[model samples]
Target chain A: MKKHRTSPTTDSRYKPARPFNADEFGRVRRILGGKVLFVQGDAAVAYGALLAGCRFFAGYPITPATETSEILSQLMPRVGGVCIQMEDEIASVGAIIGASRAGVKSMTATSGPGFSLMQENIGYAAMTETPCVIVDVQRSGPSTGQPTEGAQGDIMQAKWGSHGDYELIALSPSTVQECLDLTIEAFNLSETYGIPVILLTDGIIGHMREKVVLPEFEEIELTWRREPTKPKEEFQPFLVDSTKIPEMAIFGTGYHTYITGLTHSETGYPATDSQVDHHRLVQRLCDKIRDNRDRIVQVERDYSDGDKDTIGIVSYGVTSRSVNSAVKMLRQDGLKIDHLRLVTNWPFPEKEVAELSERANRIVVPELNLGQVYHGVREAVAGRSEVIPLWKTGGEMHVPHDIVELVKGGVK
Target chain B: MIVRFAGFGGQGIVVSSYIIGKSAVLDGKKAIQNQAYGSESRGGECRGDVVIANEEIYELEPTNYDVLVAMTQPAYEAFVPLLKPGGTLILDSDLVVTDKKLEPKKIKKHAIPATDIAFKKFGRKIVANMIILGYMNTLLSPVSESALEKAISESVPKGTEKMNLEAMREGIRLAREGKG
Candidate 1:
């Protein structure tokens, strides 16, 4: 029998420091003074999460979103953080929520089916007011419709996936660079509002490779949840301060805090049956985001010199790319048109949409799903302008010619 | 510049476009690369599209290719129509046989025996992608030759750098001599 020697590398518990040179990890590079990197959007999110001081990641592997976890698994350890591959999506979100409560930034990523599994725990995080980031890389699904294809079918689901009347922040990123930038913003928003921020991306943006210029480490902005200013005895975890957001007490800091999914009072005690208390609690939760809509919503707009013939196009995520190209092609033909690309999907920019509706002769909404955001556009426009929806499904993205032709037909 | 690379799944079709896109980025240009393919791991038709520009690239997918790199017959047949008028077409002469009568008018064509050269010179067909990249560099100048070579050395698998570089150099020589 041949003698087998066990190398140190054979030990499963032993992780090599700096597994490869920084240059070898094509996923990201910050050396040589801000050089560009060609990386997938998923990898960019992972880098963004790392840069935003996210110290804990618990994720269950799923298609399209798995790369995010894989990159984080390799990176978190190198940065003195921890990444766990949980048993299921529920446990994944649960673990991150726990980590967040322990005074660390945490996150979880999943696709449509896995996101479905995480809904209840996401609600738990919401009720407890834990700050954590959840990434839903949307794919075709009512229930596991297409595993490997791309779709923006979860725009509404991101807002209402959990039960109850609560508000959360959802951002849609179209480019690889935006994937990095918006993920940092998502974490900041979550930390700022004490709500779970959703980085809602599609399979195309999640899996596609593009050139990204990563900001320097010192240039990145990071925010943390507001901590209690009062003493441990007087600290109220759910008290609505003047900021409309409650301050959180760390779990092991000698503060007596009660955290529950039940409707709770300002002192963090469960008030299961009191309607007035329930009303106040839920209203505060919703109002924290609602009152700050001006600061929360981000939209990119381009107008066509007040041309009467110009139409307004509203799009987000991958569909925004096609809409942009279509607008350019139409403009080359002297057909005036403008576009509003929604970077923040939820806390919908109704005011901006209404303004565009008032200006343009017609408003065109294009998306990968069958008229999800279009409904919101129509509601915002409210018969002021014709809201035409160009919807496509079944994993194929809208070609530029199709969108341009639709606009042309409308113009005619 | 919008470029498309198409071939069978195992031809490193995605990697070729990826390296080119990375090269452009290293040269301080914006580039985006997207790919589509069937479920099969090796035999399915694979295609990749890359766009490089001085400004931000808003179009995620290419509408009309400025350059088309077709490494197989099926790829040439499928993508030739999508090439812009007067665009450049790069072909693997050993794999793609063009019908002159059916070819699009006014488009410049540069055909090279990239696969044959990779197999004959380096004894590995996988390096054909690097050869095509080298040939493409001579035609389009999408990125500098040094930038592409740097991207290749960083992208390919370990220990195969020598063979891949040799293949690329051979391709550049063929293009320079008008031997393809």
Candidate 2:
């Protein structure tokens, strides 16, 4: 296993993003210094991306996610960064990948309909090992089911939307502050793993306004992808060390780098005819993330007194907020229950869910969709506990009373 | 405290909830504000919700509102029953006539000609929401007056803050004189 670094690390050879004016930076810091900002989750994501050193944004306007691009368009020009309204979602993702290849931290924000259109390029970014961020503010969907309403309907599509077996990282935020904090985390993780990371927020959280206090700029940790150390004459863009992550050589850096969506060899050239080369390339793409699962996966667990079997609630995104409130109501009624909230949903956090199953007699998985993460939890439990799913759709969030009533009724 | 503001889309119904939520946060309380998004075009029925608490608020949308401010009859008829028992209801007397059958009898109800006052005093009917917001805040005291004024000044459109603040003060005077 690779040694985990606690603080963000940037390769010494990598060039840092251009700094904005001192007066402007200080003004932002002062405004956010202990002052509670009542801002929508979409605006919070834009601020987070700006703080994360993301200098380029290319996105088409979509409900629940349009505010992010709108805010970025106003702020990015002030920081001397670029923000463009792409022709469509495909072009938006394509532009970000091109920007990333040029060595700039780039991102795009869109809803489910746009997300579906970007899947091909998302896969292209994964295969080419380009780092970028994609913000999917999920609305009720299955072909524009409800554009403005919130839903967790895209849980499975997020992981398998692209046609591939590549490992991906997706982080879900339940609160407006997390929309800001986790966007930065998504960028850092994307850089660290050389993969496109998804900030999977929903319309409910995306449009809701709440209090947020931004930390001082100096306190924020940021990670930059490792740069190639070898001279231009000797550099192999696809070569890797024991870490299995290749050192990225930015375009126009005098390094002869070749990138393609096709399976390639260590020299960064297509080796489509050889099964061995394909296997080696694909395995490293997947293993680079899987091997670092311990570092990438994060979850929050609540409840003490794990000595006996209790009711366990598993949830993610905005649905987790309902779970939190329900658990409090249940505990007040003298019910023994635990809660596990998934902050990083892509890697699945199977071990944590499995452990919760051991401590609880029955697990309740409440989601905005008809049962997506519930299936994953059931498989992770593997019969150690009974898995019950509370499925809700049509975009209204699960109220605390819904979960409380279900638990009180003792219905499967 | 949970409050809902209901009116036509262009009546600043959502902005009223946002201002109160910001004022609560300024007063050192946690607050969350949300609004019904779609079908909120001008002249369409709209509603905005706000929840203020000293602790972390887990509920995103409250089913029952402690206070409901209705500026139109349709809005009043649609959301009156959602007011909790013994809750307060503030209505625009010029626009909404209450139906006794639809409202909770135990609830406290107050009427003010907010739109008429805004049109007469401020010459802009859009400022009516500010008057209603001030009246509601005075009756409930959900946030400090200083915080509410600051939030109002910051939240209203630039150059219109003075007029909006004046309208709000007029509302405060009305409530003090037992007119609301």
Candidate 3:
């Protein structure tokens, strides 16, 4: 059974024991500015859709993530947007893809089980090179273990969830504030790369409240799924230029285009020839993201001081915050601990990890899931430096002290 | 100045904490509010922590809590170690039966009949969270009495606002009068 954890916000029992300070609260609130809000990660996705020019949302109610669909149900109608709660994850994804094809920015959100269910469709999106956004507010998985708790368990799934050799772009946020910011980034990357970008969130980062300075509407750069400049008879959705980014045209927009799950050419028709347009189309999908990597990846480094000889901790999602906590405390104690917090989880951040691993003898990768991202880190750092994978599951975040102790123990 | 509150899920945890956070933000100080909850909705242990620092606060949880409000025995027992030695622990006398093993010379635990007072005087079980919040003013004079009162008045529902403010004022009165 795929048991899911539902976040309890509307419950009457929700209460806090202490008093609050709004003006003092406003200080940090002003940082992100107008977009600032104390919201869950699911709601953050809904807002990200609004920011990303996404006009449609299709999703089923999945635990630790149902609220994203619920918020969309309420907010979509007001924004001239459409939200459909389909029967299952597969259908949910199908609706979003169809909506995107018919010329609307679209998205869907789910957890591990739903993500697993959507794998075939993800392959379809990848092979077809369709531009869309899929958000997985990751939870404990394999067979629905713990739902409400947070986990970075889906790092591997985000990278290789679909059973094919396709390119994927995933973004992991460390806080609720980043949830909003990164979801927008996911939408941008999805549009820019013409692939389905995943806004990867764990239970903790999705729901935790941090002062988010919301950017005003004007500050956000919005991109539409590209439309063809040529006449309707001469349109090709899969055609690519020097940037390897293809111009996407809607179905009903006077451009008669046919899109399929099979490898297709620039003319929107399937092809089996490996030497011709088939290989070229596939390569474009990979290069549009893999080649223009720097513009697509965002990683935050703390206390690095540009030296890696000191213990370096690499983490993402909620565990990254614990790493930050551990790093901040270690720095306060006059310890040289450099931390790499990966906001962009996909494309694996191969270059930066290699750069950091060279100077530092000790490197720790602490995650909420069991060794998913650890493998990626190990592969990137290779055997030149020590890449330790510390993972915890079943509804608990890795403590900062444990991360610090792990780093210190690496020295011993 | 970070007022970090931790308690189990059903102990009016987020409500009382949000009231304080919302009030603090209105008072013009930079504030950050956060909560931690388990899977279960009602009885799961939870914590609502707020940071009211003068500047930006990168740290999320209040590891060093300034004012700790705990209603259940487990909640108090869990967070007492995180206090900065001299921090205050306010426990509801009704829900929490065991005596807090607090340091008399350093950490002082104030026992208030909060829920009982609400049930008897206010005739509402939910007001217990408010009664203690009202009494908190006595120990915490960092924010002004009027400011906290204004916070209470502005918060809560329209009809209940008056009664909630009264409960908060009574808390202030009790705190001012002391437990003699």
Pairs with backbone N, CA or C atoms under 3 Å apart (clashes), candidate 1: none
Interface RMSD of each: 1.7, 0.7, 3.1
Q: What DockQ number belongs to candidate 1? A: 0.53
Put the candidates in lDDT order, highest first: 2, 1, 3
Please list the residue runs of candidate 1 whose C-alpha ends up more than 4 Å from where it truly belongs after superposition.
A1-34, A307-310, B38-44, B73-77, B80-87, B96-109
DockQ per model, Cα: 0.53, 0.89, 0.30
Top lDDT prediction, candidate number: 2
- What would the per-residue lDDT of candidate 3 be over residues A7-37, giving only the tens digit for each residue? 1111122121121234423342343234334
Worst lDDT 10-window in candidate 2 chain A? A1-10
Task: Tell me what fraction of the real C-alpha contacts between chains A and B each candidate also makes.
Answer: 0.69, 0.86, 0.28
Model 1 residue A55 CA deviation (Å) reads: 1.7
Q: Which ten residues in a row are the worst by lDDT in model 1 chain A? A: A1-10
Q: What is the lDDT of residue A399 in candidate 2?
A: 85
Candidate with more favorable, higher lDDT: 2 or 3: 2
Question: Estimated TM-score per prediction?
Answer: 0.89, 0.95, 0.85
Flag the better candidate by lDDT, 1 or 3.
Answer: 1
By the lDDT metric, which is better: model 1 or model 2? 2
Instruction: Rate residue B172 of model 2 by lDDT.
Output: 82
lDDT of each: 0.84, 0.87, 0.72
Model 1 lDDT tens row, A341-408: 88889988898888888778788899999889999999998998888989898887898888998888
